[model samples]
Target: MRIIKKLGNAFEFFKGTIAINLAVSILPLLFGGLLLFNYSVVSFGFAISLAVKEINSKKEYLFYFNNGLSKGALWFYSWCFNFILLISGIFIFNLINRLF
Candidate 1:
């Protein structure tokens, strides 16, 4: 339950950036970066998204911080959320490639 709530808090960030993040993840494939780097480029995208969010909406985090979610905890949850998303996306892409 605690994990779920942490993830839920993270989702607030993820939901806003999902489209941009997915596009960023795909860009590496377009240039063959994925073959060499193995999806690490997605982390750059995550970092950029987090930076933008923090810059644009620093106040939003206060709600999370007040609710026992520190900056570090929120950042951890966000990273975990993106990592899970990246892995799931790769798995689904590979599965579809196999099917087709």
Candidate 2:
């Protein structure tokens, strides 16, 4: 029973960490997508490359990517950040266009 309780706690902790990582990743992912949508393939590619490099270099820091975390968590976080950033850029552009 004690062991089961410990396992439950561990699983909860893992879930919480992944949630945090996902939140952190959303903005960057959005920006990358926005860049690509704006026809800046180079910028998008650069952003992806940079993200990959950062992930690889800082894998130790990422709870999800390293054994401490999980690769899925890391990837999810990165994807979320980039997607949110791109969406935000698009929203801002639309707002400006409407204002004008």
Candidate 3:
């Protein structure tokens, strides 16, 4: 239950950025960056800055900050949520490949 709420909170904050997150996270697998397996780490760092500066206006940033979630925590959750999706996508892609 707690995890679900956390995910909900993060999802609400990050819903707009999902596509961006997916594009960046997949870049690792794209350019051979997967050799070191740093997809989540890179995405997490990218999300912290992207969430703050790229996603929305300053007013919204403060809105999140004022809502009791520290910037770091919010971004961390954003990263976690996106990474889970990324991993699941990879799994499904592989499954489909094997099926065909």
Better of 1 and 2 by TM-score: 1
Candidate 2: misplaced stretches above 4 Å? 1-47, 50-68
Best by lDDT: 1
lDDT of 1 at 43: 72
**How far out, in Å, is residue 5 in model 2?**
21
Local lDDT at 73 for model 1: 79
User: Clashing residue pairs, candidate 3?
Assistant: none
lDDT of 2: 0.48
- Model 2: weakest 10-residue lDDT segment is 37-46
If scored against the real structure, what TM-score would every candidate get? 0.76, 0.42, 0.63
Error of 1 at 42 (Å): 3.5
Q: Write the per-residue lDDT of candidate 1 for residues 2-100, one digit (tens) a residue.
A: 877867876786686656655665666677666532454357666766777788879988988766788777777767777777678679989999999
lDDT of 3 by residue, 1-100 (tens): 7667656666776675665555555656566665333564345535654754544555565766666666677777766766676577679978999999
Ranking by lDDT: 1, 3, 2
lDDT per residue for candidate 2 within 52-90, as digits (tens), equals 546555634454323344544444444454455556767
Better of 1 and 3 by TM-score: 1
